[model samples]
Target chain A: MAKEVRLWEGNHLVAEAAILAGCRFFAGYPITPSSEIAEYMAVRLPQVGGTFIQMEDEIASMGAIIGASLAGVKSMTATSGPGFSLKQENLGYACMAEIPVVVVDVMRGGPSTGLPTHPSQMDVMQARWGTHGDHWIIALAPAFIHEIFWATVRAFNLSEKLRIPVILLLDEILAHMHEGFRLPDSSEIEIVDRAKPTVPPDRYFPYDESQGDVPPLAAFFSGYRFNITGLNHDKSGFPTTNPEIIQRDMERQRRKIERHLDEILWWDEHELEGAELAVIAYGSIGRSAHAAVDRARALGIRAGLFRPITLWPFPEKRVAALAEQVRTILVPEMNMGQLVLEVERVAAGRCDVVPLGKVGGIPIDPPEILEAIKARV
Target chain B: MAFDYEKYLRMERMPHMWCPGCGIGIVVKAMLRAIEKMGWSQDDVAVVSGIGCTSRTPGYLDFNTLHTTHGRALAFATGLKLARPDKHVIVISGDGDAAAIGGNHFLHACRRNIDITLIVVNNYIYGMTGGQASPTTPFGMRASTAPYGAVDPAMDICQVAIAAGATYVARGTVAQGLLLERYILNGLKHKGFSVIEAMSDCPVQYGRRNRMSSAVEMIQWIRDHGVPVTRAKELPPEELEGKFVTGELHVAERPEYTEEYRRLIEKAQKAAEGAHG
Candidate 1:
């Protein structure tokens, strides 16, 4: 079979990549920028023997994906700002219950419904802290069409492997933009299925930590008569009010994610051979930062780019290490200053963290990023 | 094999959080009996629930169960059913959880005609929240929120389910355990969306506050006014003024949601092949 070179929109590529990655279920409500993902899925999923539902609302869409995940399917949903906010409650439910799901939030500026068809990376902090309670969230942002497709696949792979939800963040520029896409050969790309229980059906405990901190999940109707609950439970999966058990559940949720940071976090670091300045950025903003770094280098300034592919574990150690190597680290974002606060907090006194925030539904350009680097240098 | 309630229930989770004399237990027992009678293994069943006293039913069931957040069980069950069409998905929810907060999901699930058995324990009040007025709370029934008495008329959940396109819709009182059990059995057997509204008594919440003094009085009220569909057909409309008919009130044949989607997949796959050609 010969591979086809296809022209693909960012959203279409995400849908194609997701199907290739074995996303058999998708439920979402239409919202701008994100609607293309839903539209593509609605037509494409059925052809691949997958289910696509335009739910009554975003809330149900979130709920449906969580349910499908619990039933042992690779499930996902796409939405924008308002829909993302609507999904927060069930996203928290997916976290507490340890259901593996993928949520794609195509950035459109907002505190409310800001700019529907324009790009903004305002959800950086919200992506991590949006859900209530203590939760380990893995979010991936892509700057271009190819990256969005890969991010969608990685989101599914990481979700199944980690037994937690993954958010694939894309700005409107990345989601709706059309580009020549080399159709990824499904067989060439690695895919991961969720781990199944090794124990006998009768002996199964849905939340059994004895198997591992991240317990193996048995599909709902796979003859494993286990239980799942949002409430904190013991090994038997019944709701436990026991304080020790509650503490254990909370600790395990936090510790499992923290321990696996090395496995989850992916970052980009450019030339920094005795460079005095570092520019840390993410999403589409990082694209500009990359170009700016190149421009700065041409201008005889020593600067490097550190782009974090994984947002939640926040690449703390990497940022901290980078901090020690530089006098100042400039953090630029499409938001007022969401990711910078995290960068600043981690950098500590090792460096002066400067923030270059951009809003009004527009992405910062290379010149803008170069200005930030020049001023800081 | 004889039906064994103990085999299906997790006794350790017992002394279930339901109040004394509450009818939620009866509904759970009836559902268990239905499962037992159907000869389905606990392994093949996924019992899901939203938050409330009735939602807690899945916690005690020795099945693949999920106790989810308030009122989203149908939406959750929709996904579960679609993912593994081989598994039977059953949802247990409360009056408020099903008809109030979760009503939109319920409507959509029915509209989809998804293969899910939703059995709502309509207790007329929010028992878990301490007797607040619920969607099914009768007009003039005093509740914690309606101290002076509920001024709004109650919403009939059966009509809502039918209107939402549920293939099977039925209402049964908890007092009539045998009959409710039969309807539940039929619901479990139904291939499309099925809704079994088990109108139950909340002795601690709605009963104590209202004129009903004991669980018996509440049970008696249903026993007296609850007319069977067969009998209601014989009686004049004026003669059955306040009586609500029980027994399988509605049954229709529709293409089940997941199965329809499966056909859609075949057609879409053929279309894609043609496009490739």
Candidate 2:
């Protein structure tokens, strides 16, 4: 088949990719920079025999997607900062219940509703820790319009494979940008569906860990009259207060991601061989970091760009290795140094960690990053 | 032969967490009886609930049960129903869970007229949190938060459901168990959004704070104040003060949300096929 090349807008590609990823249900409330995903899904989902619901609020959107997911459908919801805040409790429910659902938070400037129309990486930390409780999350930050499509696909795949909520972190620029990319043939794309129980309904346990860290999730109405709850539960999926059961399940939930970090972590590094200064960036800022690295190398600065596509689980091992190889790691982001803290924490005084933090709704331009790189040199 | 309650109850999950004389168990029994009367298999039903004593009903039910976050059971059930329209979906919520923090979802669920039956157990107070004044706490009722007296007017959940466009609306109390069961059965049969507000007793939290301290006293109070809709209509407005009318309060026909969406999908697919052909 001839490669199907096409030009695509950012948010529209998210909707298309989600469809390609077999997402049959979407429930979302409108929020700036992310509303286009919902709008596109509204028109597109029905055509593909999928369901799209414009829920009453962000909380409902999150809850709806989780519900759909529990009923054996791949589901997603999109939101920005304020909406993301409203979704925390339900997001925590998804995490606790071990339901597979994807949440896309198009980054916007905000502590509250700081800047709706502009972009920021303020939600970098929030995506991982926004939901209450002790749980690990897989968040992907796609740098370009094409990557947004693939990232959304991967988000669903990971969410299903791991039985956890995956966050697709897109900034305002990446969310609204236009770019061209070649679409893979249907056979070329990889799609993952959640594992189903091999045992009969009576023998099925929703959280049975004897199978593996990621238990088989029996869909509701699939002859599995099982219980799913937000409360701490045992393998039978009923709420339990037994200290040992609670601890084991909590540990298992954390290990579900931590044990598979290598499979879950994804990133692209440029020109890092024997580089002295490493520049770390993600999302829209990654575009600038790539350009800045090229500019720095042309000037004999030996600066490399390490863009983390999978932001959480934070690529700690690789970042620590980079710290050992490089003299300095310069972290640039749209927010006032969110992921940089992770870099610093992992770097752990092994190398000088410099943060080129930028807020106020402006993209960190290549020249600014280049200037920082030159100064580091 | 006695009703086989054990057939529907998760034997291991009992005895339930509700306080003694709490009417949540009665409401749950009524719901189970309704479910059984509908002739739906336990596997074909999905019982979802938010955070509350009433919301805990799903935990003890032998069905596809989901104990969701606070105030979001209806929203969650909305998605579940849309995904599996074949499955009978029901949301069990409490007064605070349905009318306070979750009020927006409740109103919107009614407005959407989705094929969902929401059984709002109106205990008048937040029993889970120990007698906090909820949106439905009666005026002048004593609660822990409103120690002096509840100054705010109580919300009539049935009226809210009716006004918000629910296709079927009914009010019943735990005192009239069979009536509540009948209303629930009717709600399950309704094609669109159905709200059955079961006025239940939170004897430990709500009744104790008010004058009715014992379970019998609370049940007597409920039995006394609940007037059948037919009799209440005959009584004058002043004579019906402080009395709630039981039985079906509202019924309107509209396109159910899931069915409408299915038609929409067919239309969209046809258009897409036409474009492709």
Candidate 3:
């Protein structure tokens, strides 16, 4: 059979890809810009013998996905700005409890529901630090419509394999866009499941790191009964106040992600062959940055694009390398200077770092980014 | 023969954090007895709780227990029940955890009529938080936050559960141990959402602030104020003033949520197959 091509909306593709990725449960509350994900899940999940629940609110939605995950179901939830804020508490719970869940925040204009229908990447930092305390997070920003499907599948893979929550960040534009793409065969996709304990129920510990950094997690009803608490806990998953245990466990959780950066971080570089200027962007604005880079190159300016697919665990070494090779790096984003802060820190005055920040609830067009690239060159 | 409570408990984790004379122990015993009577496999039961003194019950139980964030136990339990319909999911929460911050989840869970039993320990005060007034604190009850006495009217938890569409709604006091166990057992056996408002005592915090300064006095007060629902109806409003009606307050039959979803799945699968055909 020739490759089957289908026209799919971005949010609908996320729901479809979740099913293909073995996401068997979805719980969410309706919110603008991301509601289509929930709507499609409601219709599609049951068809695949999966469960979908419209929870009472965003907090409950987050809590439900965590619960489903603990019960050994691959689970997810999707929301927008205000809803994402409401999910922070349980999101933190998922972090502390080390439950693998996928949360999609289709970004819209916000400080507080500033613009409901328009696209904005204002939640770049929030995805990294929305939940309180020092916890590990893996956030992926996929630019293209087709990438959203694979990115969601990858989100589930990372979430389950690393035993941590994964945030897939999309702006309203990508969430609402329609595109025709080939659906890959099921045999072509790689799926990762959480490791199960080899020990009998008698000796099982939910957070044991002796086996590896990411402990094997047993399903709730799989004859392995263990405790899960939001409090700082010991390897047995019981709450503990011992400073030694707390310090060891907290460090282990961080190392679980940090040591695996080689597996977690992803980015793309374009035309960086002795380029004089590089434009760093992600999410919807990444498309504009790519266009502007090509335009600048056509205008006889040495411009390149560094689009980060994995926003967190920033591509420090690559961008720093780019900083050395290029005279200037222009970072354009939907929000007022979020990712640029990280870029600036990594550059450390080795090269000039400029930010083209916008929050007007619109995409930063190619010409605008090209103008920034021109000034720097 | 004496019952082996230790068989169901993680004895190493105790002595528990509950203060002396706390009625939470009584509620825990009743729940264990009910579960024991039901003969449930320990591995198949998942006990969940939110933040509060009562929420500590799950930490002691030797089951698949989850100590979740404050007021979200029901929300979490909902997901667990839906994901693993074969597992027996129960939630333990305090008045403030259930009816205050978790109030939205509480109402929606009842309305959804999912097959899960919720035990809300109504201690009338936020006992874990140094005796702050809770939603269940009586209008004139003294608490740390209600120094002059609580100005807000107390909530009738059983009534709220019944009105919110819980298929089984019951109230039992710690003063009535065996009866409390029976009510809990019935709630567990109910086919849909079951709410059991366990009227427990917070003698150390609530008792000291409200003049019932000892465990005995608090138990005695609850015993004196609790009238069986059948008898409560015989009394006039004036005669029933400042009293609570206990026992099984409401029972109705409804389609359980998970079972309904199973049917939905079958229909959806058929429709999808037909579309493909």
Clash pairs for candidate 2: none
Q: Write the per-residue lDDT of candidate 2 for residues B1-277, one digit (tens) a residue.
A: 7889999999987898888899989999999899988999888999999998888888899999999998999889999999998789999999999999899999999999999999999989999887999998888889999999999999998898888899999999999999999999999999999999999898899898888999999999999999989998899999888888898999889999999999999999999888878
Candidate 1 — which pairs collide? Answer: none
RMSD of each predicted structure: 1.9, 1.1, 1.0
Scoring each candidate complex against the real one, what DockQ results?
0.83, 0.93, 0.94
lDDT, candidate 2, equals 0.92
Q: lDDT score, residue A88, model 2?
A: 89
Regions of model 1 farther than 4 Å from truth: B1-3, B230-243
| Per-residue lDDT over A306-345 for candidate 2, one digit per residue giving the tens place of the 0 to 100 score | 9999998789999999999999999999888899999999
Off by more than 4 A, model 2? A1-3
Tens-place lDDT digits, model 3, residues A179-230: 9988787898999999999999999999997978899999999999899999
Per-chain TM-score (chain B), model 1: 0.96
- TM-score per model (chain B): 0.96, 0.98, 0.99
Cα lDDT over the full model 3: 0.93
The sequence of per-residue lDDT tens digits that candidate 1 reaches over residues B1-277 is 5557889888877778877778998999899889888888778899999998889889888888899888898888888888988878899999899999999999988898988999999888998888999988888888999999899888889989999899999989889999999999999999999999998998889988987758898888768878888999999999887567788989999999989988899999999999889
TM-score of each: 0.96, 0.99, 0.99
